[model samples]
Target: MAGQSLGTILGRAFRLRCPKCGGGRMFSGLLRMHDRCSECGLVYERDPGYFLGSSYVNYGFTALTLTPAYVTLHYAFGWTNTQLAFPLVGWVLVFPVFFFRYARALWLGMDVYFDPQSFEDPAESEQPEPPVR
Candidate 1:
């Protein structure tokens, strides 16, 4: 299959579809993801520590989004740090959980976009070479 555009990949990621096929469902449940894409059979986990990168995405996204809101509320509305503590803590805790799937999906999609070979069929890539004899 030809490569998809960045927009298409991001769209698939946001929708939680397989980044390769964009048709198969990415997750079987809220936190449980399938081993591979149902439609294209592309493996989701590239390595044991693959999904750890998604935690960075989650943290960066939370910080980038919430920092603006926090600064605005603190300066413009004169909200005290104590007053915002509970809500900020709750948002920090909850947003990561809510965004977990998407963060992982987006991370995978971005990786696939940059490293196209990673998404190729394993069977195709694993063919044995002919003997030199």
Candidate 2:
């Protein structure tokens, strides 16, 4: 594809860009996307209703980052869930927040990367008007 496409989007996810634009952030905070990006004016809140594509990306991220920790506990030191409780819990504790950010970022990346219009297209998109207009 002339556009960056999915795999590249995931790589950009690691870098934390708007996967589509690759020029703005994928997050504005722990659980929020700024209504738009400060740099690109990409409207994150713009009806990303089909963000489910990134659900697996976020889940895979969880599996990749956490599974190894569990494996290390089991193989390196023969730790059971009881023994690995603290470390496992500590790792698992961040799951929701991490996944939220991960999902949003990954989704944005996919949209923007494959469809630049996911970032914005001048002619087809409209600017929000002032209350008077």
Candidate 3:
């Protein structure tokens, strides 16, 4: 698959099942990854260099998902900015460590399912695709 189906993609974003086959579990636990998909032979490690992007993803997900929650909690609980932000921001700051491993695994799986050339056999690198007529 060039990419997983929409349901699978959402599941991936939610850190759910394997995106390709959509049935097997992707993570060994909350943040640990299986070396390969039980359903498809998708290797969990797409590139050792890939996870460098995990920081940015972790930050983005944090901002998108948590910022509104932070604001809402402040209003709902009658929390002063300092009162709310202190502990909440501290929690937000720590969220990345807990999230990074899953995010790194996500980046790897994304490269696998979404990268056009990802699943192609590296041994055939010298071969060319048939030219369109």
Query: In terms of lDDT, which candidate is strongest?
Result: 1
- Using all chains and alpha carbons, the TM-scores for the candidates as numbered come to 0.88, 0.64, 0.65
In order of listing, the candidates' clash counts read 0, 3, 0
Residue pairs of candidate 2 with colliding backbone atoms: 19-109, 20-112, 20-113
**Which 10-residue window in model 1 sums to the lowest lDDT?**
118-127
**TM-score computed on alpha carbons, candidate 3:** 0.65
lDDT of 1 by residue, 12-92 (tens): 999999999899998999999999899988889978988999999999999987899799989999999999999999999
lDDT of 3 by residue, 1-133 (tens): 3445555565664665665566667677766777777886767666676568877888887888687877787777677887776777787888887887667756655665566366655664556879999
Per residue, candidate 2 scores C-alpha lDDT tens digits across 1-133 of 2467577788877776766556777666666566766675666656556666667777777778888988987999788888888877777677856677767777667666667654556655776877985
Ranking by TM-score: 1, 3, 2
lDDT of each: 0.91, 0.69, 0.68
Predicted model with the maximum TM-score = 1
